[model samples]
Target chain A: MSLFAVQLRREWLLLVQSSEEILNPLVFLFLAITLFALATGGGPDTLQAIAPAVIWVLVLLANLLSLEGLFRRDFEDGTLEQLLLKAEPAFLALTAKILVHWTFSGLAMTVLAAVAALILYLPVSSLGTLLISLLVGTPALSLIGAVGAALTVGLKRGGVLLALLVLPLYVPVLIFGAGAVLEQMAGIETRAQIYWLGVISMASLTLAPFAVQAALRVSLEQ
Target chain B: MSMSASLSVSQSLKAWWHKLGSPRWFYEISGPWQRLFGVLALVLLVTGTVWGLAFAPQDYQQGNSFRIMYVHVPTAIVSQSVYMLMGAAGLVLLVWRMKLADMVLSAAVPFGMSMTACALFTGAVWGKPTWGAWWVWDARTTSMLVLLFLYFGLYALRQAIPREETAGRACAVLALVGTVNIPIIKYSVNWWLTLHQPASFTLTGAPSMPPSMWVPLLINVLGIYCLFAANLIGRLKLTILERERNTQWVRALVREVSA
Candidate 1:
């Protein structure tokens, strides 16, 4: 097998061994959706109106929570530096790591977001739109969040700092991702919003890895 | 003959670039330029404020409140430009490992952040009489707030990293990332219903307002750019001294000043 494929397998096995890595953000998304429903009086009318935004925001936070540990383990074990150094072709290891991270965080949150949307009384008509938006948008969030993670991994106190750095970057993704679902609910054409979300995801997928690689070097150099 | 002349010009440009890399050379050369910018900033700012606030024609619609554009427009212009400047500096630092570039990046942030804050404040103040609210999540205002948050992130990231070089490079990465995201934020934010008026000045057209109004605005914009330059140079000088304090030139300069 190619080294890149091997790296992917290695990352998948590591994540599976610690299954909570995948479960944690899903659980967080579910609970946060419930909390939002509770805090806003659980009225179906209000929940239905605000459901897309609420779910999108919670999904963002869930991805953020999962991202805090994206490189923490490898960094702590000195494996990150080695991985960067010797991963056959450069960036494949980091790419594999981010791909695995998205699977655990972004992909899982997409599934959980559907459940969260239903719980918030989202219209059944809009369910597919919400799922599609999350599936397309959350990987961009993971990519962006990984840049923040790589930047902060060397710091002793990085949690709050990570959120502050990454959230502003998340604004566009949030806007388009949630806007798509909201537009579908309003019976407006959501093609533009979905296309923009895809554009953002594609842009991040291409660009963010370079940033992540540079940031990881900065952190490791320290 | 043309080729030889071009070669010589390029050779001089290369030499000048290397000279700028030396902190002491920059310190010495910028001394007179800083004074020049400081004086120009003060003179232009004072004249523009007087002209804009007192003598310019009142708006046919909004009356004297439109005069706030003198402060608001220049600051908003400078804040965004300063971010772009820092992003360019960040690129230089990351690609070329230029020490002075990083110093310029660090020096530009607080000034840029304050300019953003000033723009937002003046924007809010202007909004109250015009929009009937102290704040609105209009496209411009919301994006400016996001810009402020971006500045805060860079500021906090710099503070969190203890090592100076590491901090600079890390902030460079963050700054470049922010550069990429700014347009996305602007475009996304514009999807909201916009109440803030479209820009009054356009490069391809005459000013929307009379020269009596836009001239003062033009003056204020020039003044603010000078002020920003002066501020950056002043801060950069101090950063150079502090960073290079152990070096002989800095010590000699200190002794010369003290004596």
Candidate 2:
């Protein structure tokens, strides 16, 4: 438990200190939303029609953009090797790192999702479902994305490759998250989809760490 | 008497498992299987494809185009099975550190990939005649595309790493991770397809397909399985050769072949 706390604190320190890492994705979120709005000519219905898919996709993209390099810094400086050499399960440290990265990317994007909702002129009624779905879904993104990040950390340039590796796994999360928003938009009760998103969140949280742990071990050995 | 018989069976099984773990032992043993399955595949595939293509009666609904099912269904089933086989191989490689298991896992991916491509192409061609478009967002095709991507990622990853051992381990973890996605993709696509379009085409709409139709399909499916096995063993032998090139066993085998 104390080890987990220490790991959390260390991740917290790096996360808060890396302001550029945090800002870049937020800016990307903003730019992508704006560019999409401009491209669609700001038609309210079309924007609203596409808002669920658009917002969720951009959030996914932004989360991925942020996570692409989440572990490279640690790996380069040999922190990963030292951490792996320790007696404790490396998954605890990995979970903490992913949680911090999720905070910076997925959690932040959920909050920004509402503002983007407004920008896209989504009906105010659907905002609650949108936020809830992103909230439930994004942790899975981080957990799964961390596995991809860990696997690719040994590659000198793994950004594009990491995206390729992880994006397909994100489909269920996208389907449920965006599907919930679309449900709310269509006046259907979204309880089922939201529940499914939560299930994914819990599943990925518990399962992805093992994959991440093994992947990190392999990468470190390489 | 029964107890003694079971004891010997168990002991032999253990011996077989250990021998299978060694590349040298595996290479020595698998030659007969390679040739046998290769011949079986060649014979069965030719017969099945020809039978399915020319002999099967036209589908009352889809006409001659429904013939693509012969290719599509088999490739689809085999591709999924191939992924499962790779996952199982990944498990063995990771747990047992067996070189033979890793060889099977890596050697089998491209065949699995091409199977996915063939399924997708046949699906698309089948779609054009039936669904009226080159592509549709139906769950099966989408999931197959994703399957293709996972293979691409695994293949690319294996290529990216410099060392063979590290590449194998990384692919092991990745292949296992990808296995988790397969069932999820399967069910999600099922639900998605049902939600989007109810009652899509079936292999044979009738409760039981007549022998004229499904016999050929079954033959093709079994033939493809044999072909997949043949290709996998052949590739495994080649991989064993390349990886074991410096070993004395391999050197002797090479000299034996030359002689």
Candidate 3:
């Protein structure tokens, strides 16, 4: 099998073996939606008003909660060193890890976000925009978050530091992702927001692996 | 010592200037310039602050509170600009492996932090009167806070890494990657229809400010630039001393300076 495929399979197994990692973020997503429903009096109008931001913020926090393990396990078990030394380019390996990260966190967030959108009374028409935005934007999060994870891989209590490093970088993705849904809700053409989000994701995909590779080299060097 | 000799001397000076692309040459030559700029910066800062605070006119709308702009606007501008400077340093460090680039990155952080702090403080003070609140989560204010966090992240990442070269590379990558925020900070108002006003100053066109308002702002900005240069020099010197302590030249220079 190709290295990328093998890496992806291995990561899938690892994520499955740690089911809580996958389930916890979904729970957090559900709980956030629930809290917003309760706190805002379960009024559809109010929930709809704040739903885009609430959903985006929840996804952000969920991804952040999962990011610490992205590189920590490999660094701890010496697998990261092996990957670094492999003949295959480190950027490719970084890309594979990011793919796995997105598959687990980003894909799960997409599913849970759909459910959350329904609960929040997001318009039926806006659902397509929400899903498309998440599909494009979430991988960008994983890709950028990989750089943060690689940089903080072996540090003690890296979770908070990882959030500190990665969250601000997520703002553009948040702006566009949430903005797309808002635009759709407002009866404007949402194409520009999606196009910008796609552009950002493409730009980040092209550039972030190098940063991840550089950061991983530094992490392993130490 | 001859006329042709003088011409050769000027040529060599130009050659040396060209070689400043090397960190070692930069470290060697920047020592004296650092001290000179440091003194100049201190003078400019003191004079500018006193002139700005004591002499600049109150805004027609903002009154004495407008004087806070003397500190706030300049620091806010410098905070973003310094992030770009650090990113340039990061690019040099990554592409060329210049140790001075690492030093430049390190030198920039404290200055960046101070500038961000000054901006936040002045923003808060200005907000109290203008917005009727000490703080608001407006786009500009929120993004400036995020910028502060980015600076802290760079510093914290540097501390977390155990090896110097590793730290340098990691922080450099982080700096380059995080620089996307600078433009966002600059245009957040335009992007979101934000409460914060769009930029008052522009390069290609006339400024929004009347002459009375802009002249002192221009001076204050120049003064802050001078101060940033001075602080950078001091920080770079300390970085050189720390990194080069084992070297003979550093030891000799230390002895000479102490003497």
Chain B TM-score, model 1, reads 0.92
**Ranking of all candidate structures by their DockQ, best first:** 1, 2, 3
**Model 1 lDDT tens row, A139-165:** 899999999999999999999999999
Per residue, candidate 3 scores C-alpha lDDT tens digits across B1-259 of: 5999999999999786558555556677776776776677677667667876887666666667767777888899899889889998898889878777888898899999988988998898888976678976666676788799889999998887778888888899999998865675345324553322354322212336676666667777877887788778778878877887888888887799899
Decide which is better by lDDT, 1 or 2. Answer: 1
Q: State TM-scores per candidate.
A: 0.95, 0.96, 0.87
Give the Å shift of residue A80 in candidate 2: 1.4
lDDT tens digits by residue: candidate 1, B56-142: 988877878888889998999899999889889899899989889999989999999999999999999988887788987777788
Candidate 2, residues B138-223, lDDT tens digits: the string is 77888999899999998988988888999998899888888987887667666556555766555345576679988988888888
Model 2 agreement with the true structure over A64-90: per-residue lDDT tens digits: 899877998989999988888893977
1 or 2, which is superior by DockQ?
Answer: 1
- In model 3, how many backbone clashes occur? 0
- Report how far residue A49 has shifted in candidate 3, in Å: 2.7
Q: Give the distance in Å from residue B37's predicted Cα in candidate 3 to where it truly belongs.
A: 2.4
**Model 2 stretches with alpha carbons more than 4 Å out:** B1-11, B198-206
